[model samples]
Target: MTTREEVARKAGVSVAAVSYVLNNKPGVSDATRQKVLEAIRELDYKPSHAARTLKTKKTNQLTVFVNYLGDAFEAGILNHLEMESRMFGYFVNFQTYHPEREEELRHFMAGRIDGVFLLGQSLRPETLETLHKAGIPVISVMKPVEPGPVTAFVDIDWTASLQKTIRHLKSEGHLRIGLMANLSETHAHRTRTLAFRQAMKAEGLPFGETDILSGGGRLEAAKAAMLDYIRIGRLGEHTAFVAASDLMAIGMLTACRESGIAVPDRLAIAGCENVLMTLQTTPTITVLDYPRPEASVAAVRLMVEAIRGEPVASRLFDSRLLVRQSTHMGG
Candidate 1:
């Protein structure tokens, strides 16, 4: 079958431009539209389904562009986003945002997808321009160092949250603390890392060379890294550890268990998510309850407002700390 890619090649324009012409969406000039139509005629190209959405009206469709859905935290956010989107008469879908394939984004369901929620992505300036020309608004769930064309950001106050966590750890007598975080250096994780540093600074604690560790954000890699640290006796450097996610905290617990290290006695650990597993573990994890649902609602609302051409501002929600056995001071 003749494909859209073939048609775009024949038209000598971007695949996204072809999509605009096919759906009668604005942003493609008459000259370019004519070329796309001519290419379709020559190639006998047919879209899988004719889009019923009109460019002028709300399609009630939104998509979330994310780095990965594999992480429990991200997956949980997607679940809440879908539920919350329904409350506003919108349907939601998610995609693994591949910044490497820049054109694929604008070329995807162009007419039907109204806006995008960036879970953790940095859309390059050119890619941002393409989305802008295509009339799609992009909103980040985390603040950017420089928001190129992003409509708004809906996120947590990472600095404040981390500082608060630090205070709680300090109260528990964990002055010399270390951080465990994801291996990927996305903007959100980077923000968290910076916040951790600022939090340590505010507490007058020194974060030296061995103070931070990065592994996979999920369970297995975290356990592996912890095991390596234990074997090398680096785990003794800090009385307590602050994990960026609950999964990492659990992995640390698992490592401690395997290595015959007692929790709270040998070390204390605090995590960032208050998910169920945090409680179900043998030693309940101390955590900062991530406001996933609230953030989802805020992100959806901002996208809806932006879709209507309404003025939108960035929103911030706070995470509450929940103390558990994992970070209790040993008697």
Candidate 2:
């Protein structure tokens, strides 16, 4: 099928300009419109009926771009985003994001979705520019970095949350503390790592590269790393571990279980994101209760406001700790 994207590429014009010309909208200059029409004729472009209708009016469709749909926390946020977006006459769809999939994402922008909710992927500069020219609002959820043409974002105060967790661990008499986190070079991962350093410094504790372990942000990876740490004799005496995610903590628990180390008694552990799997672990993982629903609602609200050309500001939410058997002092 010859899409408007092909016509836009052939005519050397923006996709929005092609859309304007095809729908008889008054946005593109006459010269550009003529060029687009010529390109359309040359390419024999034929849009689908739904695409034809979208060129003329709003489609009321929103996209939720995720790094991975299997993530428990992201799945919870998707569920809430879909449910809340319905009140504004918007429906949500999922899209997997990877740096190499820029062309696929651009092809998806043939006047289909009204806005996008980015969960964890960073859009390329050209993709952001194209979306901007198309007048599409892009709101990121739990993205701490500043937007580069993105409309708005929602995130949590990672420094404060991590500090609180660290203080609690210290108060529980855990003097030798270490951190386990995903090795991905994302804003959230950096924020968590920095916050861990700041919190340890505040508590007058030692923070070094040797104490911070990277597990590539997967369950098996974390488990393997922990087992290696055990074999390397790095699971020091009376140590407390903090993971950047609940899945990592669960993997750490598994390592401890197989090594015959008692949780909380010998090795206290805490994790971020209080997902369902936290409770399902052998020793329920202590985790941070991230405001998933609130963040989802905020993202939807920002998108709706931005789509209407209304001013919107980025938002930040707070996190609370959920103490469980994984780190309970009494246990």
Candidate 3:
């Protein structure tokens, strides 16, 4: 394999210069940096991550912990996080944690990683405290738990986002709305569910006990919940359905289609996260675009600053509703 020494020899520069250019250090001139990069490409050189970590006293690795919700929406967010971390000269390690497990929290605090990205429902206060005590920085990608000293987060105002959707449905003259939620122990799911309830109440809408469907955020579970609702003769009775994630929304739609229920005519469904599959469906799903890519990039930037002991700013992005064919009421 081609080493940094070989690239430096080919580029007629010192190994230190090659290191500076490869690591994106600011001292090297642009022209010399270009020459070193050209040589690296010609020689197909790859740096040793271990050696780099040892030299810098940094793992150059970030860990992300996501709840066990294996939906397309979560997958899309993970993809963006991976891409953004790469651009910031760090590798990402993702682990699934049980939200209710205190042991999992302890294990995460064992200092295996430089920093952590939390992508689940709200984190426990104790967990935050422990991580803070360990001097580990955490950035929440989508779910912001209560604020603590060491935690920084970026997320949309979920309550307002759901209220907008509820208002849009209300304008369509739909007074009764059904909700499909994962109801998991994670902070994100809980927050979205609470927002849905609050929006329904604020809009003076009657969300009957029969109108709420519980699922596991899996397609099959969501489909089953919808099917049960239909079997109980409650599908078309509610004018609209609100789902916590696009996967659940699509599942609800699939169940509706199989039962010969027309979308937007008999039932309108909307979801969060705006996954690609939601757009490619027959009647596209209306959803809230959370800008996961931008959030991921921003999180990495903050993580890098924190790693360098530099002051960083907290950020939050607004969620926008994308009106699609599924909720085709003139907005």
Ranking by lDDT: 2, 1, 3
Relative to the true structure, candidate 1 has a C-alpha RMSD (angstroms) of 9.4
Per-residue lDDT of 179-223 in model 3, one digit per residue for the tens?
A: 888776555777788778888888888876667789777777998
Tens digit of per-residue lDDT, candidate 1, span 107-183: 66467677878875777787777777777888877666466568888778877888888888888878889988774
Quick one: best lDDT, which candidate? Answer: 2
TM-score for predicted model 3 compared with the true structure: 0.78
Judged by lDDT against the true structure, how good is candidate 1?
A: 0.80
Candidate 3, superposed: residue stretches over 4 Å from native: 1-57, 100-111, 123-130, 145-150, 208-210, 311-313, 329-331
Worst 10 residues of 1 by lDDT: 49-58
> Mind giving the per-residue lDDT tens digits that candidate 2 earns over 157-181?
7778887888888778888888887
lDDT for model 3, please.
0.79
Superposition-based RMSD of candidate 2 using all C-alpha atoms, in angstroms: 9.0
For model 2, the superposed segments whose C-alpha errors exceed 4 Å read 1-54, 144-146
Residue 153 of model 3 has an lDDT of 69
> Candidate 1 — which pairs collide?
none
Cα deviation of 113, candidate 1, in Å: 0.8
Q: Better model by TM-score, 2 or 3?
A: 2
Clashing pairs in 2: none
